[model samples]
Target: MRKNEYTKNYDITIVGGGLAGKLMLAVLINCGVFDQDKLCWINTDNENFKDVRVSFINYKNFIKLKKRIQLDVYSKDYSVIEKIELHNTNEKYPLKLKDLNNHGIIIRNDILKQNIKFSEKKIDIYRSKVISTKCDEFNRYLFLKDGTKIKSALVISADGSLSPLRELCKIKYLNNNLNHTIITGYLECKNFNNSTAKQIFLKDNFIGLLPLNDEKNLINFVWSIDNKILDTNKINFHEKIIQMLNKFFLKNNLIFDSPKSKDDKFKRVQTYPINVKFVNIPFKERIILIGDAAHTIHPLAGQGFNLSIEDCFDMVKCLKNAKIIGKDFGTLSLLKTYNNIRKTRKNFITLATTLIFYVFSKKNNQLNNIINYGIEKIEKTSLKEIFKFLAKGY
Candidate 1:
């Protein structure tokens, strides 16, 4: 069958309608670049409108979101975080986010999606998968699974880490698989408040509890142990999680009321390898990549969404400038400018997070001493300012 053709082509076609794609649409439309008729968005995931994963928005990024999209309505279901607490299982020292002057916000993915849905002025969203994409000298072709093809001046790939468009474009990436798994779930605690986020670093693992509305909280447990410990056939995952939680609470002398009923209604966990990688070139010819399609970092600092948003910001800025100069938006020169501006910041974040993981993952006495001393110095210094700057997407 001849692929369905678009006689009236769009100026730009974006793949993947996740947070990154949606945000880009908002930025471009709000900037008055293209109305609904000129922008096309292709998304394959149709089961749910948003992802369940949560993201923490720092002050700086929050401002950008407000300016780029309608945020007042989205803030209704989100939680504002005033402090973050970090503890070492074997040590007495703990760090708190109150040391930092500014606070962050914890938002569910659904809220973000809803906000975008409300803010989008005139953008076409296609609920179909992109099977293949090719670029020639003049126009880029995107072939959808449903026998439709779109020819546009530029194509943006925000599909994510294992992007089909990036693969089709033959882009190379550097991958670092940490061989670790993070298990996350929601817990109902009687005494857990919504004002603080907590992280407990243990000998072989770490636990992060982020408070949501009411008495509910989200728990992210990251274990660096061998994957064999998770027995799929016989072991009860919830019981194991509860046991670990109790052990940590007991060890730290923290108090919390037991569940009203133990029916396992709030028990769910997913285990996946932590991988980080970056594309050598984020753009080529009439094709460009953003968000996880361009790079993915460890989730330790919860900066993945922030980085993706920043990517959209930079790309939109570059495109706006290109338009002013009457230059092609997808040219290598424009993309190189965007890449050069973002690569240094991305490298710095990747290295910093990796260093933190390495230092905390070790159990040697000398390293522990060094970490302890470092923590003491950080507690006394203005490191939170530096951290806030990075977290706020400086």
Candidate 2:
């Protein structure tokens, strides 16, 4: 079918059903932008829709989500995180979350999906991949793989790093692959206390323990090793992982328990190269990109999802205010405001995460000693507040 052949016209068509897209839909509905008949959500996958990727949401985002979305429903699948702990492999000093007088919440990607489902907005979900998108003088058209098309006043591309829509729209981006791999999975560890998140920095890689429900834990293992280490057939990756984890837990003197056999919920470790990118412009004509479509950052600090949610909130606020003032909400000038607000913040986070990775990834004796002393001083002083400010998505 031709790109403009679809019959349905939407006010806003979101091009991904991930956290960012769903949050944007919920925000529009909450703002009463349009009744349940104006939005279309498109995606290709039909899995639980919850990203195994976990996010540590700050206090501000927690308040916004509670006020604007369905928190009760989200809580069923996520955890309200009250604390976080950061450890340096060279020392015993650790930074604890309670020192900052702030708490972060953890939510699964699927929980966000459920929250968006509660919106009264008229949202239609299309189970087809977006093949291409085009903008003409009046409207934006998204061509789907199922021989269908959607036209909308505004098309928000939340389709992530390999965004087809962004490519189709010709949005220029700065891309860099950091030559790292992040392996994420869930483990059931006893006596986790459900209150603290732990991050351990080792010479070769990093391991983060995010406590979910009472007994379940989410682990993100990041390694900055040579790319050859990721070759599936050439390396005994699973055995290597077990060895790493064993040494990690042994160093920390923390007991490790295998996942429950009944639960057997563990899947083969998934590996993805870490890439960072920032769009020169997130909006063009009637097309705009949000979340990973606009920028992708290092996951070291777990700020990607929070940043995406903030983008959704900011876009809704700007558009709503423009509509109330009788301004052209869909115009490039107005859309540029959204990009401007998000770009600086995203860049700061991207740079900060990169710096953190560089500092801790060093194994030099002098740098390690300096890091150990810094950690000790941080634990003894108010420096933790600064760390929390960065981690809490300020």
Candidate 3:
């Protein structure tokens, strides 16, 4: 990987080969929308299992991507969630939501990456860091840390939230530090059927118990708590978590048995302060941002990756249209269609998830009553509609 050894030019260059970038590349290659040889992808990490362990993918979105890439929907690696149960710390009864036609799929993050088919013969993948980027009216140049310079008509940033390209583009955005730290890991439990997704809204924290695979014995949990609490006690966090799970399930009269301390498989406990970040426009100049680089929401809703896929899907359509019409894919007008189509929907989701987090974080009697009343009023129609919206994004 010598820098001055060679120079390459591509029709499109995608930065950050995480799930979003890889999926986008897979779709583009499979769709035949772009010349496979002309597309370039860059990744710092070679698709290793990062902090993200699992994701809850709605059925419709899964199907959509599967059709585009011809992935089998009934893969053994994915676990189906027939129902979702939501409980408040003070409420005796939990709110259950389900859709008959569609269900959520819990998938290991690394497995999804492994399934993506990108032949090295078709795609030019550079496993080097981007050292610098220079753009002009016609083309954008990407300087890799290895000194290989790449020229492309369009540069896409699928990088994470702390995207250097997002900052380099001089795009102004609102970044909020939620002051909440999230602890995510897996647990092995007994007598728990993997048919349902469970969420508990505690006073100071929010917990999600999503099943992994078909066996249903393993639960992937995400615990979002106040930073102050995490700061106070760094030791025995998982031990305390096991106690809480046992207590909560027992108190709630759940059918599942308590988590076993000795048999539990602990991968790694990770913590990071939550942030609600959004860019007014996801594209600037010849660069477009997708995935976390564009917008990041709270994990409680499980829409972060879904939203990224939606954005990438729409961007694909835009590029196809531009190709059909003999227009530059990097044209602002062409990119604007994607931004306009996604911004409002993304805004609504961001706002909705943030509001839900706020409402559930504290015990507000009036807000709770209003939520309950609204849920009761729209329970039948809205749940189905919401699930479809989340699943299909239509």
Candidate 1 lDDT, tens digit per residue, 111-165? Answer: 6666764344466667779888777877798877787878888888899878888
Candidate 2, residues 42-116, lDDT tens digits: the string is 866666534555667887887778888755553546666677777776676676767344577766555555656
lDDT of the candidates, in the order given? 0.70, 0.72, 0.77
Candidate 3 lands at a TM-score of 0.91
Give candidate 3's whole-model lDDT. 0.77
Number of clashing pairs per prediction, in order = 1, 4, 1
Cα-based TM-score, every candidate: 0.89, 0.89, 0.91
Structural RMSD, model 2: 2.9
Candidate ranking under TM-score, highest first, comes to: 3, 1, 2
Best by TM-score: 3
Error of 3 at 387 (Å): 6.6
Residue 144, model 1, lDDT: 79
Q: Which residue pairs does candidate 3 place in steric collision?
A: 3-147
Using alpha carbons, what is the TM-score of model 2? 0.89
Error of 1 at 329 (Å): 1.6
Sort order, lDDT high to low: 3, 2, 1
